[model samples]
Target: MDVAINYLEENFAERKIKIQAQEYLHRFYGSLGFKQVSEPYLDDGILHIDMLREK
Candidate 1:
């Protein structure tokens, strides 16, 4: 996933976005240098979090 993200980041110079499956997945995203935006909240019985990484 990291490799794919790096490819997208490099290929899409105009658009900057990263996605994860769930809030728990934030840790994986963090490993790739993404930062959590706020506390996680319940969404359809599951937790969700927003994260972003600037290029």
Candidate 2:
């Protein structure tokens, strides 16, 4: 993930990364510096929350 982000940073100047994380992995991603952007919602019946990380 870091490699891809580094490449994007060099190639495109991205400012943030966004994801829809499963309920169980919120803390894991949060620990990586992601922050919640939206309330939880179901995707194909599995709950998810939108998260974002500034690059």
Candidate 3:
């Protein structure tokens, strides 16, 4: 995870990295600088939330 993020931080020109992650993993992603950007929702019956890490 760190490796991928580091690569994006160095090479990607986008303003942020976005992901739709399992709702229960919010804290885990939060530790990596991601913040919840959307309310919880179900995707194919699994609870999920949208998050973003700004550049």
* lDDT values, one for every candidate: 0.72, 0.87, 0.92
Whose lDDT is greatest here?
3
Candidate 1 residues 9-41, lDDT tens each? Answer: 678762456453478888788887778876788
Write down the TM-score for model 3.
Answer: 0.89
The CA-based lDDT of model 1 is what?
A: 0.72
The C-alpha TM-scores of every prediction are 0.67, 0.80, 0.89
- Point out where model 3 deviates above 4 Å: none
lDDT of 1 at 26: 83
Top model number, TM-score: 3
How many clashing residue pairs appear in each of the predictions shown?
0, 0, 0
Tens digits of per-residue lDDT for model 3, 1-55? 7888888878876579999999999999999999999999999999999999996
Q: Candidate 1: where are CA atoms >4 Å away?
A: 18-21
Candidate order by decreasing lDDT: 3, 2, 1
| Residue 31 miss distance in model 2 (angstroms) | 1.2
- How does residue 52 of candidate 3 score in lDDT? 99
